[model samples]
Target chain A: MDKVIIAQNLSLAYSKDETIINKANFSIDSGSFVFVTGASGSGKSTLLKSLYGALKPIEGSLVVGGVELCGISSKKLNFLRRHLGIVFQDYKLVKEWTIEKNIMLPLIINGYEKSITQSQVDSLLKHVKLQHQAGKYPLELSGGEQQRVAMARALAHNPILILADEPTGNLDDYSSQLIWNLLEGAHEQLKTTVIVVTHHIPETIKIDYKHYHIEFGDIHEVV
Target chain B: MKSFKNHISLVIALVSILFSLQVFTIVERSIDAYKENLAQNYSLVVVSQKTLQKKELLDKITTLASIEQLSPDNVIKKLNTGISKKNKELLKVTLPKFYKLQLKIYPTPLQLQRLQKELLRYPYIVKVETFSNTHDTTYKLLLLFKNVIFILSLSIVLVTILLIFKELRIWQFKHNERMSIMGLFGAPAWLRSAVLFRLAIVDALIAFGISFVIFSYFSSSAWVSEQFANIGISVIVFDKVYDSLIMLGVSMTVSVLLASFIVLGHKEEV
Candidate 1:
């Protein structure tokens, strides 16, 4: 009954001259795993951006975790980010910092003390099976490894919700299953609300997860 | 940890600017003090004659405003007596009867040679001369030594800043990124203004501290500090007070202006 994300008549667009998705509507329940599927330009990523406070809605309303997304200030956006975990298909890790430091970025920006940052980084690294690679830089990590590291960093501050946009879009089958297992494990163990945007729906995994396909520029749940 | 390491370069840059301004103020103040002493003690001559009618010469010399100071008439009237008085005071009197050269205009080093030409024409006048009264050669060499020290001090400072800046930029970029984001986050305009205030105060303190130490050091030296000390407490206090204050005020104002420019460049979009 509780909604983690709610959008009513949401219209997303880049400019006044062009509108991509107009009068869109969606609601995602708390602690539920869902897929956001669409053709190449059906606005799946755009929808995900709106959920995590990236793109502002042009002419409709959107609420994520009780905070309005449209026209939100950067301060509130950062505050909203504290409760959110975002995993990009292309992991946006700082090239200069070590893997551990990259994972600790959100914490550092938020001004977390030095003493607790180490122990916190250690626990998250172990959770993501990345404890050994903590000393390496982002450039040193493979694509799959970098994504996992991004996942670990996103989860570092114990965010309430996780939004993964095309998490397995560029991964091999083995790496893909491993990533799904990690996402599933975090959700089941921590009861974190997770939304995953993926192209492939592998049948081997047994879990109660909803599937939503984007068609005719509208989102519809499919069995 | 990330924020701590970030902005290392910015801090190093700030410290370098601070120290450079410090040494510059010192060297600059010393040069200015030398120039002032050269002007203040310089005398202007209306009449220089071995034999002249005293009452007639008096009418010729009193009209120049720049000639506020003249030798005690005893040097002209009781010339024999004035020489004896100076002889008893100077422990190392180089000459028994050194002509008290009257300066008709303030002579900069370049213009001082004209005194040579004029003295040559006046066959009786041995040489037109201005003498520094102190025994210490250190003050005479103050400008040269400070210039050397300025170069040496800045070389060390630049090298240190280069090393430090390299390490700091690693962390500084991220710190700056987050800070810029924080401001763009619509961190109340008032808070960003607070950062400006912090910048102004730090720059001002640096300028003030440097000027105090620099002015004190150069002023304490017996040869160069004569103007700074005697003018402050003695008869010329009013004459020199404006210059001393101007030196301090300019240093503070310029440093604060530089800091404001840096802070302005960092502000976020409206």
Candidate 2:
């Protein structure tokens, strides 16, 4: 399988004096589901941010979807991000927009036709079991519903890679299981590579998957 | 509702500024016309011992438009109340010749005084009366009025610009979250700022429409006509198509420019 992401001697930081991820090396294969486990403030989120070009690699090379992100131009970074889907812990839905419109955001940004976007959004709403809440605003939805909406939004454009940061960190057991099932379904059925950062790794996941644990600014693949 | 309120405040500010601009233009034009009328009606009276030719006065004072010889019949009649016919005729022959010297335009106080001195240089000319006191007072009053309007218009322009900028900044803050999310989704700068542009354009159009109605009514009102008549000058308060187009252009340019400023500022911060 082709590698979708490759990082060699990568170091991440917000400023010059404070490094988050130091000398880390990793590669993620296409169509693979991977879990990054770490303690609080162990730079799991920083690693994910680096993958999306939000933070630059401080020391070495990092590439995602055939684009080098170390010193990417804004044009190049935006182009690379077009093929990526990202989900945040807070859901990050636009409060003034309806649930359906929120899900249609990525498709609209990608310049999809209105008819196609509407059909895809309808299908995603059904998949997320929020078809009845399509017209409601994000503020009107519950936490679990909002997260589901965010998931639908992330998958709206059918991106090749999905980066989820603590997607189930604040959800109840039922919502967490639902989000896990959705992520697993996308990886298996759509052949999409997914990288999730979380403190908990459910033991009942029955799939061919990889695990990388971060400890004290170091990342290692766990057998 | 809050958005509507914000838009209304901006529209009101823009309309007041645009209206003040139109009023300034009209008042300036009216003052110019009034001064032209005054210049046409004014003339300097010169008394000479010998009858003077119009060409001679014109040559002496380059500013002179034309000079008319005043008949001595009125002066002789006023003095003939008790005198005999022969004495009245004798008094007319002894009186000096009077000429009215008209000018091309209204003269300043200094120009009037200079003309008086130039006319007095001739050995035949005896006295020159320019009526300088009344003319000088009227000229000063017109200048003071123009300065007051100019300062008022300038103040309105500065205040309106600050108000528009503040309102646009508030709108930017309100939409910042949505715009940032859109930006994270690989949306371009134009796409992220589409909503702000729409808001600015709509509010500008609304202000233009309101101004159009108010000015149209004022332009045709009887009170405005009466005021112009009192001053003996007909002024145009507004032009339907030409003025509207100008106001529309100004309103849109200001709105769009301010909106673009906010968007660029937000982009820089990001």
Q: For all the predictions, what are the DockQ values?
A: 0.08, 0.51
lDDT of 2 by residue, B90-135 (tens): 8888999998889987888888888899889989999998988889
Q: Which candidate achieves the best lDDT against the true structure?
A: 2
**Model 1, residue pairs in steric clash:** B5-B171, B6-B171, B6-B172, B7-B171, B7-B172, B8-B168, B9-B168, B44-B103, B45-B103
TM-score of chain A of each: 0.93, 0.98
Question: Which has the greatest DockQ?
Answer: 2
Give the per-residue lDDT digits (tens) of candidate 2, residues A109-153.
999999999999999999888999999999998898999999999
- The lDDT per prediction is 0.63, 0.88
User: Given candidate 2, what's the lDDT at residue A69?
Assistant: 93
Clashes of 1: 9
Query: lDDT per residue, candidate 1, B77-128, as tens digits?
Result: 4445545656644522332233333433335444554445544464444544
**Which candidate has the top score in TM-score?**
2
- lDDT for predicted candidate 2 compared with the true structure: 0.88
User: Where is model 1 chain A poorest over a 10-residue stretch in terms of lDDT?
Assistant: A103-112
Candidate 2, residue B101: Cα displacement in angstroms equals 4.6
Candidate 1 achieves a global lDDT of: 0.63
